[model samples]
Target: MRITTLAAAAAFAFAGSLALAAEPAQAIRQNLLALQPDMPIESIAESPVAGLYQVQLAGGRQLYASADGQFLLHGYLYQVQNGQAVNLTEQAQSKAIARQIEAIDRKDMVVFAPAEAKTHITVFTDTDCGYCQKLHSEVPELNRQGIEVRYLAFPRQGLGSHGAKTLASVWCAKDRQAAMNLAKARKDVPAASCDSPIAGQYQLGQMIGVQGTPAIVLADGQVIPGYQPAAQLAELALRAGK
Candidate 1:
């Protein structure tokens, strides 16, 4: 889980020429499994770079491995063309976020929206995060501007912490919206427990590069990492929708 860049470089330096006859994806999986049998590999696919494959690991970590599976690069991948450097890693992550979001049902989200919403954004929020509270306070204004806000729990502390427990309570409450508001306001909601999606949401947040609370995903799968004013967010959402 914690392979240093220098270590990876040394690894590649020693084992860069092991060719494989199998498909790139299968060969990479086999190579990685041989290295660490217990490491969870979620997916493998062709990367933007020729002869390099993008590997998606459990918990959303990504790395680039050579097509032959002998070299691994543990950093961002950039596509340079026409005097510009485009972050190919981020672009791929955005597409993956879009696909994952599409699989989520609205019923699992806590939403605030106008009767006829122009667009909706998904937010990964933590109950104890100050910026998350600031963002929640603007939900009504965002709704008024015809932008729906859907919230998924991303407790800064792991699932066993008080923050996570509080989020679970919010989801268990009969009035989920009110409970969320109370938690955001730093007030305690009645402790409750149920079969909730908090754990899955937290994992999803990690996969989509949500390092902090109030991480907002716009309609086009563009990730805005912090709080934006209601009016500005509404404008951004409308533009992203188009």
Candidate 2:
């Protein structure tokens, strides 16, 4: 009986070692794609923890799945040790946001770059949002401090609403930046129909989990959920590696 028990213990150790040797990147992604066919896979790789994969979706999103494909989790992932939160998922999200923002066309954006710019930030804005307007009012100050601000459309109202109409009008205007300024100042842009990228930007914002106006994307891809003062925003831009 003792001999049999010893053999069982050795077998269990060997099995545990085998599980530890398995690489997360190999097969879990294929299974996750199979499970959520519509969710485009942006990245998949081994995580800090064993038996899990860190999956970053396109448009600054993140999720996790087990190596065996038996389970999936989507939300903020925290590593708790010594009373501290180590967020591996947030790091993945930042990287994802950086990539997506880099892929945006410069022409479609309204840019305010400082002559001595040391940082770049992207803001998802809606003209009609009061807080968005408040944030825009500080753009000039932010730019003066060598922080470049890039605007992406996130109409608070869905498409065909007044906010969307205003965004579309801004895209249609001859001087895009000036039109944006006017809109932020509560002035109307000329209503001229033009094939604009307002829809695409809005969709991208949604994909990135931007649920409100004045959502700022720092250079390092970290998101600031709400409006920040110019000084604070500049500091965030610096930390974002701008």
Candidate 3:
């Protein structure tokens, strides 16, 4: 009887490993769909921490889950031994954002680029943000100093809200650069609609932990939240490329 019990335990262990081994991608998607059907699952992969699977959403929101999908986790996960956040989710999410950003056409952005273009900086911006306006005000200086600034709409509100409408209007404008200037100057642009990529970009911002307007993304996928002056931003962008 004891021998039979040992064999049964071995079988159970083998089955458990099989489940875990299959999890990095498919299992994560399955669980996310199970949890929130409307949430678009973009990618799933293994994390450095054992028993955790990283789930990336279409809008750039990321999360970690147990191999079997029994538990769902949001927010930063930490490693206690060294007193540092594991940030496994952030690492994976950043990679995913890099891929998405690469696929985006340069024309989709409201670009303020230097004539001599040294570095490219992508900012998730909202017109209502004071700091975002301050950042926008530095566009000429940024361009003159040789840093290219690209803008992606990230209305503080989610899709279908007033903020989203405002961003959509700017995106749908005949002259987006002019619309941006008007919006930044606190003038309302006529409500316009288009099948813009603003929705997807906003989603990406959330997944990448962008909490506010003027959130800057460097070439290396390190996110700098909030605004920085033109010269300071230029220096950071240079260092990021290196």
Candidate 4:
């Protein structure tokens, strides 16, 4: 009886390892592409859940699937630890976002900073967004509080919007900072064309979970949706930097 039990356990272990192996990644990718040919996949790897796989799409959004690629889950994954529901998926996303933010060049963003900034926050802004304009008005005070503000264009109204056009103009302007200020104040910036990062940044905002303007991203990849007061946002940045 004991010998038979040990043999059965060995068989189960082998099956489990096989179920978690890397061979399923190609199948998952191929099958997913068949469903949505335009979907861009960044990576596929085994998830924390046994026999499940994590699929990271271009721009940081994710989904999960069974090892065989026959089943899919498009929601957050949680782990119950010590009676607490820990958001494992969100934690992974936060790390990924931090890495993505780190990869971006500073020159691509419109920046307002103190000579010696204590900490900085990235804001995804739409020129036509009321809340975004409100936040911009307080940038000077925030800079005074040692909080640098970096702006990335996100025309919430889609790529063809007037906001997107204005943002492109700002990017093309000889004086980007001044153009941005005029835009936030609802003034017209000279229409110009150049190789712009607006489209890319707008897409990036979508990938990073920015559904609206004035989205504040801290250094640690924590996103504060909508507008935040200068003092409060500066405090948050200081903490994240530490």
Best by lDDT: 4
Query: CA lDDT, every prediction?
Result: 0.86, 0.85, 0.80, 0.89
TM-score for predicted model 1 compared with the true structure: 0.80
* Candidate 1 per-residue lDDT over residues 133-208, each given as its tens digit: 9999989888888888899999988999888999999999899999999999999999999999999999888876
Between candidates 1 and 4, the TM-score winner: 4
Clash count, one per candidate: 0, 0, 4, 0
RMSD of each: 10.8, 7.3, 6.7, 5.5
**What's the true lDDT of residue 93 in model 1?**
65
lDDT of 2 by residue, 1-242 (tens): 99999999999999997776554554666687687778778767667777777777888677778887667888888889899998878887888888889999988888988898888999999999999999999999998888889998888879878999988888888888899999999997887668989999999999888999889998888889898988888887887773
lDDT of 3 by residue, 131-207 (tens): 98888888888788778888999999778677788888999999998999888888898889889889888877886
Residue pairs with backbone atoms closer than 3 Å in model 3 (clashes): 59-203, 59-204, 60-207, 61-207
Which scores higher on lDDT, 1 or 4?
A: 4
Cα displacement (angstroms), candidate 1, residue 208, comes to 2.8
Clashes in model 2: which pairs?
Answer: none
Q: Rank the candidates by lDDT, best first.
A: 4, 1, 2, 3
Q: Give residue 83's error in model 2 in angstroms.
A: 7.7
For residues 9-120, write the lDDT of model 4, one tens digit per residue. Answer: 9999999987657579988988899999998788999899888999998766789998789999999999999999998888777778878887889889899989789988
For model 1, state the Cα shift of residue 174 in Å: 1.3
> Which 10-residue span in candidate 3 carries the lowest summed lDDT?
84-93
TM per candidate: 0.80, 0.83, 0.70, 0.84
Residue 125's C-alpha lDDT in candidate 4?
A: 92
Best by TM-score: 4
